[model samples]
Target chain A: MATKKPKIRTMEELASAIAVSRPTLSRFFQDPESVRPATAEKIRQGLAHVDYVPNFFATRMNRRASGLVGVIVPLLTDPFFASLLQTVELAALEMDFTVITQCSHGSAELEANAVERLLSMNTEGVVVAPLGEYGSADALRQLGRSLPIVFVDSRPAEPYTTIDFVGTDNEQSIGLITDYLCRTGAPPVYLGMPRLNSNGLERESAYRRWMAGHDLRPEVLPDDLAPQSWAFETYAYQTMDALFGQGLYVDATILCANDRLAMGALQAAHRHGLFNSRPGARTRVRIAGHDDHPLSRFMTPALTTVAQDIDTIGMTAMSLLASRIRSGKPGEETVERTFPAALKIRESA
Target chain B: MATKKPKIRTMEELASAIAVSRPTLSRFFQDPESVRPATAEKIRQGLAHVDYVPNFFATRMNRRASGLVGVIVPLLTDPFFASLLQTVELAALEMDFTVITQCSHGSAELEANAVERLLSMNTEGVVVAPLGEYGSADALRQLGRSLPIVFVDSRPAEPYTTIDFVGTDNEQSIGLITDYLCRTGAPPVYLGMPRLNSNGLERESAYRRWMAGHDLRPEVLPDDLAPQSWAFETYAYQTMDALFGQGLYVDATILCANDRLAMGALQAAHRHGLFNSRPGARTRVRIAGHDDHPLSRFMTPALTTVAQDIDTIGMTAMSLLASRIRSGKPGEETVERTFPAALKIRESA
Candidate 1:
């Protein structure tokens, strides 16, 4: 917004400047015929006196075909998001849609700003993986009133009941891994990720439920390092190092919430000389994770994890949003589309 | 874009329908006052009959403050690019600019399409990491003529001399690592990455220069596995596996083009049972690389590499773009801004 400041700063001021009601002016912008001809004309005349980009808003409001969709993610570094965005982009391209992308980088304030930015661009719909725990519900609810939005990855906590969600069924996936670990070896000791969103809690709860079902005690590790941090690798590495200071796990089986944390746990094991032996060295630690990361197989001891099917999640999110966009309304009933995660057997566990 | 199809399809047909020339219609849309009042009125009347979204273009053309800058990169899978995008995004936010992002996914056609998408959004400026060898020069040149464009990570060859570039000084950084390898151990056998961009060739040349300076013959490996693929790890893994099949390298030291490649090479070594020994085991193969990737430090024995200041490159690119945007003109003289890379010695080498 490098343009010179308008003498009238806000829409309230502009509405007052023209002696027209704010709602009426807003209505005129949305569609000139929605307001009386005299009111619409007054709003137009007022617009002529301002340097603000109301005309841009006016143009967006008048269009029936914006040919654009916005995609907002917490961060691109998460391999999973990177893959999701790529899949969505290809799907968008096929539908003759241009994707405008913004990363919130896990900041709630920035996430809100990203929504505002997308609104200003007049995106027809949005597919966003919101900052689950830290998000502002009001901002998102406000957006839901005007445009169709499809949530990917972790759906935020309640009060977001109206938004469609497409993600891994954490219950089934985490349970699958937990079952596999128990069947093949000692029951797993749960290693958690930062409570960035619902996934952290959802995944851990699944592990605890499985343990309880099996009549075994769940060893859920307390976060001793960077709690609530997205730096999964560093967090896991440091937390694992501290755990080693106490002693090795009695079960010698670890199940991390995600593959990234597993990667770090392995690195820490290597640092503490636990990885010096072959993975099958009987007493060596067996670690597994979830969300088969792109590099999981390439890890020192290839990671054993659950695959979340990002392609399905991404394509499904687009399909759901497109239907809403085509209908030109937010759906009457929001739906949750969950996919199962498959167990990927690798060297680590 | 989902609106009822208009009776008139193409703009050319619309121009003929309205009994006006195409260029005149284009000029009118760019600025209605640029054409005769009657002609503009006729064009507006014709538009009322169509479902096309011409007003969106008109609004962008009429504005001095789009408040938007675009970023197009080849892919987000690369840790370096991921870090770079994050930096630029934060910098863009600081400037009160919203960023529109697109990924080329290493396709020249897609890169061109990304440019078109940004143009239609009427971005004030752009920071792009182009598909170096395969990029569409004409598309980028056209964009450069209209708005300031800053290149990051890699600069394309001829016909792109006009765009400002910010990247690592590969010669200094590559040479620094080469010297360290030579002084501490045997001269390194060069392992090249896919020549996806300029950095690929530049780093290799720098390595060659350092070897020549020391009066040693450089052994650049043949790209037997993946010549131009972006899947760096798999490529290096397969290539190194083939090399290992031919017996171990005589030098016993490997200098990879980037840390990702080194990672793959390391995995291949482990697969071949060469990585099972301790680093101090004199006969153990030594591996080093460039571009200290985010995960380089956590590699089994850790990776020794060079660091490109992504924070500086990203911030500098934004500053250059801001100045050009402020001047309302692409600078008359294009300049290359390169930062020297620092050596990050870890256990691998």
Candidate 2:
């Protein structure tokens, strides 16, 4: 008798009959730049026809020995930091690695302590939006040497020394805001936290330079940034009220240090009976902020601020950390990648 | 030869110089309460006078083994949580044990994930301010048998079986507020979360009970509990505006669910120009809230609120966890502790 033909199966029948190898069609899930465009398109269209179910865990594990990423942020209360933290968290989840986060909250000792704790836990690699201060640099380098440590949003004093840094160009971002205010209205008032304490020095210096280049006057308002400070929102509100009481004629636009201060300023304006929808309510004064906090879009008339590329920051950080972790590179060759910022024109501006 | 030469230090001399450890000093330093009040006072005074430093770490190590206490909260953005977290952190720091805090952000998966992560990190005990749902008593117990777990501010199902719990007496607190409103003016209209959420149920029920007992009309206004999910503040504000426009008699005391809702109500009132500063302002409606947030006192005509004993919650949680870690006794009975709330009478009331 003729040997019973081993049940003849076409490629479609074989792919549909067994669920294991469908995920091996990487050309299906990935984009054209990653795989051929025509091939990717064919696989994509064919996936629905064949009822493919990719083994995500298996493919991820096979692709890499293991996927583990660590993310660190300065503080969660600050809306900017919170937004950034949330973005990175979502991105890491998409990549299918368990992202563990720690908040340093702007304390050197606490930052160091968190770093040590993360190190003791043996995370695959770390992405730190660190408190850019003196003591943190050495600790960061040590951690970088041991495993991949990608710094985000802030960097150390010594650049091109060690580790990888990803951040928005602070000078360019603030300069754009100042230039917008000057164009739309009068010279803007720069309201910010104390200059000596943080990386805001870059923004403050940029603002001063921008004003000088435009041949305009600059009014800088710096809040005292003591350690373990009091309420920043209240501080901003009270400061603005005091300035107004002193007959300081702030121009139409106020460029805030960040969204937190701007929100506070809006609240202050409300309390002072400004910004109401009364007849002829529009004043020369306008409130502009930065970072586009989650609540910003919900605020009255929304907020006009600089939007940072959080997706890029997250992806770059992950890639840098993964490479360093795999290579175990101890050599000090720090990278500072600066991303441009875009002006998010909204009602406030 | 030294003994023969009488090379000895006198207690009087030592006490005068280092200013500690005489007849009763040792007991006071070891445990302050063990000594008589007068003796303890004298020891403290003498110690302060001499400016002596104790070997705190050595003393701590000698007294007990290293104990790990865990703290978990729903969100870190709310300053109420931040304030409580800080207190717990300080308490843990003083107790000389590590504290691992995880933010669940109202996610069950994240909550369980944090618990598992803490257990994997070998936490000795845990104190959780749970999201009031989806906590597994069995799995939590199985993961860390030796460690004592304490629930704070929210109780899980089967409390006596798995862990100790602590929170404020919500019913009595709300009842007191209700009584105060009825006694002073018209019966209060309860402004509460739209959803009958688990944690605030007691407060709502208490308000209802008080209203029924007094034979007063209970007008409960429902509000969006998940403020972040919707345009909550704005919705609440506009709803109140419409209520006013329809000649609604809202001139009675309004008891808000929490400080945040009260804040929105206050903004609405201000926008409508309802609140006044004249003697007639006394006749205007009053508003009060619970959970005295830091910003509560800063609001115009500072808010009247019930201040829960958050410090006690933290301290008790730490102590229970420490005890559980040290004993490692699965046979140990579970416990529950509730703290009283205090009504802070402020301007808005």
Candidate 3:
């Protein structure tokens, strides 16, 4: 018969069993580097031998900052946000913090509920990709008063004027994609995104501005998607399919607000007998998009789009939140960091 | 002029201000349904008017369950896992438990670290999509002994034989895809996934077994991708690109382990001057894959694959974990729930 092992339940008992002073054990838990690595290794091996885990409840009871942070995004099913959250988690781990993630699923009520969850978790700080105009200002202001917060990807309007933000410059990105299309083929017609988010409104205005700068007439397509809908693909497919019988985008290029829309446009084009960008056979309907989504490169004709720097955005937001937590203050002067987007020219445009 | 309101910082103060007994306020926080709707409304309004959140640490300090659950996955960047996690989070939210997510990013070491992090969080329970053969068995055993754990999507070998699991029935799913291809065209050649996890190994064996059942020779292409690399797209592209001049899969249908691989195969096929499944200019290479991934429908020659019911898998896993947690026992006779995969036929095969 196997012998029942003696259970070590507390840190003090483990320290005593391992023949180390309690303060040494405490310091090692606080920062392993505070003790020699040999001692640290001994502690680690001892921990492996027993089921004893350092109690996190003690940290919370002491009214000390829990080494927990938070992140809120609109949807995790969208590959773009999924990839961004992955990057943010990697950065958080490197900074020795754990991240609690929430997906609002594109609902204002859910977004507010997520804020309450963060408050309950006692998160040291948070990074939010706000749902633009649909977000609850009261909930956000309450949260802002309590903890360090940084916004990423999408911007919220005033009186969040002093909030820290990290994102791609839509004006520069839209201008770059628009200019590339004009140089390569017909001046692109703008296939706009849903008007719920700031990016949708900003990108359309940027496209018009770029066309104005070039002294050309901008044919703005319908911004007809319903409010708060994240289904960009369905919207683009429906819009393009409805217009296929009339002109098929040959007279004007189709520049989508994002790569997902371009993917949908490609699908509609394929269904309507507009072939691919193969060497021998190709479609005359040149299309472009922004945000170089993960599946963009796998598209049949591939997508020509602007690429946002997710690594910089994720790491910067984390580092900013880290500094704020370290300073132990709320409502610091706001800072903004904008990254320029780079054009990726593929077969489509 | 707006008058400055007195701050009601504690639960007792808020209860007094709202003219509710302390027990009523506590009951409302515990379960709003325990109180009258009108009383619940009053409490909700009071919470909204003030920045007072029920302290989670109080529950922890009482040595009560924290009402926090955890989820561990191999990668969130993979859309399959992203979609599955999204479903799991929804179920968790419905159960009124907050979820903390950890992505191991396909590393066994990271998976172990995540287990340790969960231990520190004192999670009531956790649902893990284990990293098949690459998972940390000791860490998992420790976790299993400490709390309720349910594995999803991938299976781990014994001494975990009795652990609760939810996944697609691989044998049935593989047979369906293989039978479809054999019926429609030349018997397919299997493009294997990297041998890092159980799904990869199980899928290949399932294909071989199905071929044996049909009395046909199984031609499994090399499972040559390096260990622990999640770059399935690049792997499939390189494999297909290398074999381009050697016949271009015309003699045999190319059946990939999953949709992402099939997507890559399609891209390589397109790059090699082979056209798409758009009406007239179709290529002779017929490709099929498993796992009707979210983007599988948008693939140029949209994928024909097996659809695992993620909603059933996710909800089943959560409910199992919830029961286990409610029972307050570390180990019980484990249960396994397997859902049959349905065939989603598209243009690819």
Q: Name the best candidate (by TM-score).
A: 3
Chain B structural similarity as TM-score, candidate 3: 0.85
What's model 2's lDDT at B337? Answer: 84
Q: Which candidate has the highest DockQ of all? A: 3
Cα lDDT, all candidates: 0.82, 0.64, 0.82
Query: Whole-model lDDT, candidate 2?
Result: 0.64
Which residue pairs in candidate 3 collide? none
lDDT by residue (B225-337, candidate 3, tens digit) is 54456888887887887786575564348999988888888888887766534456444777888889877888888888889899999999999899999999745687989
Candidate 1 positional error at B42, Å = 36
lDDT of 3 by residue, A195-248 (tens): 766788889899999998999888777745444567888877878888875655
What are the per-residue Cα lDDT tens digits for candidate 2 across A193-286?
5332334677777888889888888778844542234256676787777766564633257888777677666666655655555565355468
Off by over 4 Å in 1: A1-61, A223-226, A277-282, B1-61, B223-226, B278-282
What ranges in model 3 sit over 4 Å off? A1-5, A8-49, A61-63, A223-227, A248-251, A276-283, B1-5, B8-50, B61-63, B157-159, B223-226, B276-283
Each model's backbone clash number: 0, 2, 0
- Who is ahead in TM-score, 2 or 3? 3
Score residue A278 of candidate 1 by CA lDDT: 52
Q: What is the DockQ (computed on Cα atoms) for candidate 2?
A: 0.04
